[model samples]
Target chain A: MTHSDPLTIAGKTFTSRLMLGTGKYHDFTVMRAALEASGTQIVTVAIRRVELKAPGHDGLLDALNLERYQLLPNTAGCRTAEEAVRVAKLARAATGVNWLKLEVIPDPKYLLPDPIGTLKAAEILVGEGFTVLPYIQPDAVLARALERVGCATVMPLASPIGSGRGLRTSELIRTVLDGAAVPVVVDAGLGVPSDAAQALELGADAALVNTAIAEARDPAAMAHAFALGVQAGRLSYLAGRMAERESASPSSPVAGVVRLPDPEIPA
Target chain B: MQVNGQPHPFTPGLTLHALLRELAIAPERVAIAVGDDFYPGGQAPDCELAEEDVVEIVRAIGGG
Candidate 1:
């Protein structure tokens, strides 16, 4: 099935609805192959301890050709709004890309985003002409507030980052999709292909998978599976689903149900 | 003081963390790769700097 309306974020059109992260792959070669197999147009990269000016490190950056996939640099390790803003600016300058994935996690254990810090940083980044895509909790009100701040997209976590718990916030996720004016990209904690499919089926504009695909027995194959799952989910959502009923009832009467024993008759 | 394989002036008596703070660098943003080992941000305070030591303080930048 062909995708009629490709997903677009921050004026960039992506044929693939799945946004894959570049970390946790066994090797760069495997990562390259997985990215190709996944057909991911955008890949996320964390900004943490890299000597960009060093000559030898150029090979790592060179391996990722900007033409094939757009580089989305994230402020992954930031703890506060000030730190996030600073990192976002530095990332924009270093990568020459305006797109940023704002991730401000105060808690190292869970890596859960600090909503207040994320919003504060996002507001500043958006005003600074950066295309901010905040990794936020599945809070409908927070999603709306982020949209109001001119965020390019709102990436709500399906669960804690790297926990692989799957969609623990399905209800809140649905609420976000129903209310969000901007794209809702389900990011993080997607353990497998089915998790990604579930997110897509729930009307998420895109799903970001990193550890699940990278840590698989075969990263490339897993990437392909995720790609298919995302596509299936998107198609399912587009096709729409029948409303579910609380109690089970036959849509058509059974042929043998015509005669019933009298109520007073003993079995 | 030695940083990234270059000798630089340092206060006669200052902790590695103090030197970093004097440079207006956030400890969290910098990772110290000393000798053949990598020390996390928190370890900087106790790890005193020695002359001609290969103190590689790598900062986080944008890249995959």
Candidate 2:
């Protein structure tokens, strides 16, 4: 279950099923090490203040060479559809990539996705020929609606963004996986390797993780661990599971075997 | 001189970059609009400030 297995989305074939986020890293060196260890082909990036021409303005883009990985720009801070659309356009113009991670969170405290705004933005962006990947709550109906709007993929959160609570909406997530036409990516709130494994076991097409790896004690090792966990989970899903039984029973009968002295029985 | 909708004491010879540092605004987050023209990040250093110079600095913020 190596990354040799192909994952196709929006006519693009990716070798890796794990999508990594480029945030909360101690530095670019560590980030690069973690990314290499994870073997992720698609990496998520947010458009923030990065001085383009300044001598030393913390150029994250320089570190993330575009040739190696496909950059998926995100509208992380946008709170409204209009704002998201504007930011998406700017990101496309700046980065030359039509791939967008549409995240419209209105509340600063919780950072929950604004469903109405997200829907509006997705409709517009899809019309504009953008590959939309909407990060949303684990709502089956919402996932279906997004698919209808021509979304490349539906990224349902395992929990709140960066909370690391792990798969809070397991039932709804399963519903999405069962009903979704496109790929179902378990995005955010994945605390450890076990969480990623559990999501893949529940039939998630992929998992997008950031804080769990970047904030780990050793980011590179954690990234490798996650890579293996994702592969194992997908393999387990492919290998069918057995149904659970309520009570245990012996295959041999216990009560009707008392007639062992019947030597006259026919062979 | 004013920048980003805030008042500032006028200096005879002040640059946009210096003014940005004074206001604690990162140059990357802001775009300067002055005299019906918009200047991107690179133009900030050479642009000098004058009396009654109406400069608008737009900063990136969370909005969808």
Candidate 3:
């Protein structure tokens, strides 16, 4: 927590450890406020093609202040590698940030990122000079595979996307963390501030949160709480925790017990 | 004509700019694509569209 340097990923440096998601808020005003309160440097935005609003009417981009936060465009709706790459290119063309969150989820029920498709898209994105951070299941093999293919970081999901279930895949996520050389960003399914704190305490490089804060009654306050949680967790990680054992240690010396007279004997 | 996965009336001489105007989209707000080809925000005016082309109007939305 005392660290003052930027977080480096794939040769790029960012000042914020908490990456905010600009989704599920009631409106842009609250979203922007929450973003400011969180003090996030990176904001993840999805690529969407919807029915156009009236001309001169601004969308989320207008609400976003790029000077305050860097926009990280994600291939959120893409179900294949081709789709993800296409979205990635479109995002770069639009926002001009080379950093992307490569998400290719063909399965909608669980919203799990497709392993093969993610790996494929990561290769293409890396070759295209994009800093790729792939959202994936907490599969150790897939995490390593993504790292080998030149992804800046591997973001393993805590639970299903938007489930707010919180770290359903703890063991596997730990498995991935154990062997990860690059940063392991715990992404998705984080429901509370403690979830993020726990992730950092487990030695994750960071956590990307959205639904928890955005869906809260007071998003701005929740955002601040999460920022505090991240700080606490990171500090705890740096501070280190005590080891565990099967039995308890002596609280007082056995030899230090004082002798006393029996009241019934009336000594 | 399909716009945003919905069928619309097809009209000849429909340039990308006119389509945006018809849909009331501020050209600067979104990035355009016809099938797999992406055009810069400014290119929408010159880029002509063909019938049956799946035009994608991509805007930034909230994500995590």
Candidate 4:
């Protein structure tokens, strides 16, 4: 029941199993505080073009204490393998870090990943010495394929990104957990603390949460709750669980009890 | 030259570093790429900006 071991992805050990997505916060200061409360060691940032400088406004990097967390640069808008590769390289160049969350979302309506492009990009990035963690659909065969392509981790979505739909693909997620050799991270659509806990209970190595925490009234408190939920769920998973039964069974032993309940039983 | 979808007047021998300075952007906070070719680390400062180049400047933005 004790969750003592740290989570290691791409040979890097992390004390927290929860990875936060830095997005959709009303204030950056609040986001920073929420991140600290979540106790997450890694956070993902979407790559985009922007004029980040303004009077009295420091950059997101400066605002966020980079010392406390690892920056997971994501190729969010990339729709092709080539584009993802280019973005990954640019992210590495800009951040000076090889860790990347490779996302190839060809479909804009739902923000679902393009598996073909993802697999292609993962192969190239892994060959190029980058620690690639791909965001994919909840497909076990695809997770295995990605791991075969040498990805550092396989992140399968529970539902559409930011839908807050929780785990719609529970069986599929279990499929990946059962077979995939690499660590399976349940990413996206985790609505609340219980959703995150359920994913951990389903045997996921970690969960990547965003909109739910960021959109909450009190992001810091919500993040803290999620951290505790993750730990509790992971402990429950580690401690083992009873097997499922087709029918109800009595908890107390009936053999040693007196057999004087005939009136109530017949009635 | 086009920077982040805006057409900026191309200067003679403008480097990526110069463009970042022109935008008043901190270079440490962004990633720059001219088409498919990404300028990695210190090399971004050396890549010369041409008029036809569409410089895509990327930063760490909020997202899930």
Clashing residue pairs, backbone N/CA/C < 3 A, model 2: A78-B63, A78-B64, A79-B63, A79-B64, A80-B64, A81-B64, A84-B64
The CAPRI classification for model 3 reads as medium
* lDDT value, candidate 3, whole model: 0.84
TM-score of chain B of 1: 0.69
Task: Summarize candidate 2's per-residue lDDT along A1-267 as a digit string, tens digits.
Answer: 454667778989887788999888888899999999999999887765423334234556667767988888899988899878876766664456799999998988878898889999999999999999998988889988999999999999898888889888888899899967999999989999889988998899889999999989999999999988888888888886667799987779787776666669777
Cα lDDT tens digits, model 3, A1-267, are 335645777776766678889889998999989999998888999877755543454478788988877788999989999989999988886676888999999998999889999999999999999999999998999988888889989999999988889878888888999979898889999998899999888888888999999999999999999988877777888889989889998878988588787688965
Evaluate every candidate with DockQ and list the scores. Answer: 0.11, 0.13, 0.60, 0.58
Off by over 4 Å in 1: A51-55, A249-253, A256-267, B1-64
**Chain A TM-score vs. truth, each candidate:** 0.91, 0.90, 0.92, 0.91
Q: Which candidate tops DockQ?
A: 3
DockQ of 3: 0.60
- Leading candidate by lDDT: 4
What lDDT would each prediction earn against the true structure?
0.80, 0.80, 0.84, 0.85
CA lDDT for candidate 4: 0.85
Cα RMSDs of all predictions?
Answer: 9.0, 5.9, 2.7, 3.3
Worst window of 10 by summed lDDT in candidate 3 chain B: B39-48
